[model samples]
Target: MNLRRLKYFVKIVDLGSLTQASEILHIAQPALSQQLMILESEFRHQLLVRTKRGVTPTEAGNTLYRHAQIILRQLEQARSDMDKSSDTLAGKVSVGLAPGTAASALSLPLLKTVRARHPGILLYLNESFGTTLSELIINGRMDMAVLYGDHASRGLSFQLLLTEELFLVTPRGMPMPDGPVALATLQNVDLMLPRPYNYLRKYIDDALAIARVQPRVVAEIESAATLAAAIHEGIGATILPDSAARIIAASGDGVQRRIVAPMIEAPLSLCVSDHLPLSEPAVAVYQILLELIADLALGSQPPEAACAAGARPQCPEQLP
Candidate 1:
């Protein structure tokens, strides 16, 4: 079957009229009709029934339409891939990132690395909660993502990047809680928690449930900076990855962070769809991420250590 004929058929069904389809496809009406006729002849079935208002698909047409959608999508992806390969280290990359620390701690570094190594590559970043990021990656809306949680999708392959412990953050000068405060301690404490649907929230809730503690949440916030500000204002304490908590504590006035007792740790995972192959630029960025993460884990140093070690920092924090 001719792909062009299939394209014509799909356009006809979409517009519901040959005249409209021809106008949209920029083909002569007679040519469009001829293509549709050829498609119907190849299928040996009536694909559309004519009505006074417009054309409607027959049962056979509907079946073929579904397959045509898939075929067209694959064709488009192939074209995009081909175009991408024509230029080395130059293409568009869309990445989904988990909210909070993963976005700042992981995705930001990877983005900078990509920009430096492949100046021609355009980077698009989206921040989402864990499940949403997973769905985006699987659907091809995102080329890659940094996620925190269990790898639940069989269609995705994950690499274990690092394990980060959770920390309890509070305003500076606040009396430190007794050693290893129980999850119940959060009850009646002003608490800034992630939305219930967030993967980090799920991890926090699971840990609380395991400890048989119920936390009285004061508010649900999304951004790490917002949550840190809330903590600094003494609105409530929040539990977050130590990397983020420490960063926030270092910057925020009078804010302190402590590791959560009993050590609720989550594995920071880099996820990619098994169906997609990484581009050369993306592969280079991923390798840099591996090296950066290894450096962080080996010495628990901030990413700025790269700068200290003779590499210029791609992102520099403004000194307060």
Candidate 2:
């Protein structure tokens, strides 16, 4: 009935012995036994079966275990929500981002908005691959993240922000075909591909396979800056998000962009866990992100211009 009793019951089931559970729970065995008895009494069912080896969960106990896990999670989330509300928007928000393009294209804007709007909130940024970011979010190590590739978790929800086409960037003077180059064209060319372990690399490889083309990879680099530098030196052409390639093209006088024909595009996702209840600050941050995204979709108009047209200020000049 109580969270403590439920926790003790789950612990007993996990340890399979009252002595072991009590040792882990740091309670006397008699007290732990009493707690279990109270839980069974409240449920009006025999929760565990005693055997010479140890205690095993009865059918009723198994059912309660499942429900107890959810209940405990909910209770913890509620407490977290209360704590967050009491403190207002004054806690650290850690965000994980995929390396290279997504970090530049998505994380930068979101961070800028946060800095301007929530100056009191501390921001921690980490760059990793999409799969790593997802695991961190699931484990409660990150509050939210922007990731790429497939999102197949039922417990996780995503909002597709944009679809970015992949492009092959080369030096300005290099001879490029007039049309998009097929993957077969890359067979002999030095290619700077993402690491094979990366989700983006897998997606790109799958796309290449669909076209029945094999590329000759010269190097695999993780950092966007390193990849950009490699491309700058004309070491090899790298496949990158169009936005990223465009940024590099604009900055590097010698770099030229060629839109890869039979384009490979990947969805950029804003992912959050459905099982975790968001704090008021987190909810506010999410809403702000949606508003900022809407503004971006509306040509990224300046706040003054948006306000003049009776549209809500996407990045208001006020802070709480």
Candidate 3:
């Protein structure tokens, strides 16, 4: 298969419009259609189903699209590797950190370290929901991400970085137990939690069910700022990882109490694509991130010293 034709096909499928694809690709519409026809003929399958709205990929086209993305991404990495000098690494590296998790604390350090070590590398940090980050990583749009999910997820390689225990964060003026709070005690307390689909939420739900405690959830918040504001305003207490709660704790707007009698914890994993190889710049950043995580003593933190470290509240809005 011709690489150029494959590239054109991928673009057309992405845009879902031949005319739009032609405009972006700087090729005539007729020429683009001819190229598409050639590709379909080469594969001996009708790749797209065209309608007045736009084009939709057929099963064969979808398969081709996935393979093409991998091929093109690998080709770009090959070019980058070949172009980079032995002494200097230079390119764009995108890393995603799930909000409202321990990984959020590493963002600033990762950026600073990347700049100090690889001056030529342009670092792109995405503080987003876990599922969105996972999709981007799998699609080759993102280089890597640290988020929570099943380690068994297909099409991704996982490294278990750390598992941070969840803590109950209560707003100021709200009275709570002195030390560790049990899950049963939160039944009467109004809660601000993520939607049911979130992994963190699910963990909380499972813990609650096991403890036979029913919670009074007031709102479902996904944004870090909104969640923090709500907490400061005394809207409702929320459960989050120690790192996440540390953000609220540092603000003096909320107090962190470790959840007990069935503690809740979210596992943080360093995720990368199984099909796509990391570019030179990405590898450099990846190594820096691993080193930074190691230095933070993330998973090894003692229960009594959980809130000893301070962090900025970048609570995850949505973690699919």
Candidate 3 Cα RMSD after full superposition onto the native fold (Å): 5.6
Residue 211 local lDDT, model 3: 95
Across 1-320, the per-residue lDDT of candidate 2 in tens digits comes to 47889889878887899989988889999988898888888989999999998999999998887677657655654665566544456455666667654333445666777778776566778777877888766655566776675465865666676566677777665667765777667767687887887767887887778777788888998776777677677788777776566655554433544445456877666677757656555666676656654564455644422211112222323222
Between prediction 1 and prediction 2, which has the larger TM-score?
1
Go through the candidates in order and give the clash count of each: 2, 0, 4
lDDT of 1: 0.68
lDDT of all predictions: 0.68, 0.67, 0.82
Worst 10 residues of 2 by lDDT: 305-314
| lDDT of each residue in 88-201, candidate 1, tens digit only | 566666766676553345565667777777787778888877788787666555667767865657667776666667777777756666556656566566667788877788
TM-score of 3: 0.83
Candidate 3 regions off by >4 Å? Answer: 51-53, 173-178, 249-252, 298-320
> Which residue runs does candidate 2 get wrong by more than 4 Å?
1-80, 83-88, 106-109, 250-256, 301-320
320: Cα error in model 2, Å:
25
Clashing pairs in 1: 172-254, 190-236
What is candidate 1's TM-score against the reference?
0.66
The TM-score measured for candidate 2 stands at 0.64
Best by lDDT: 3
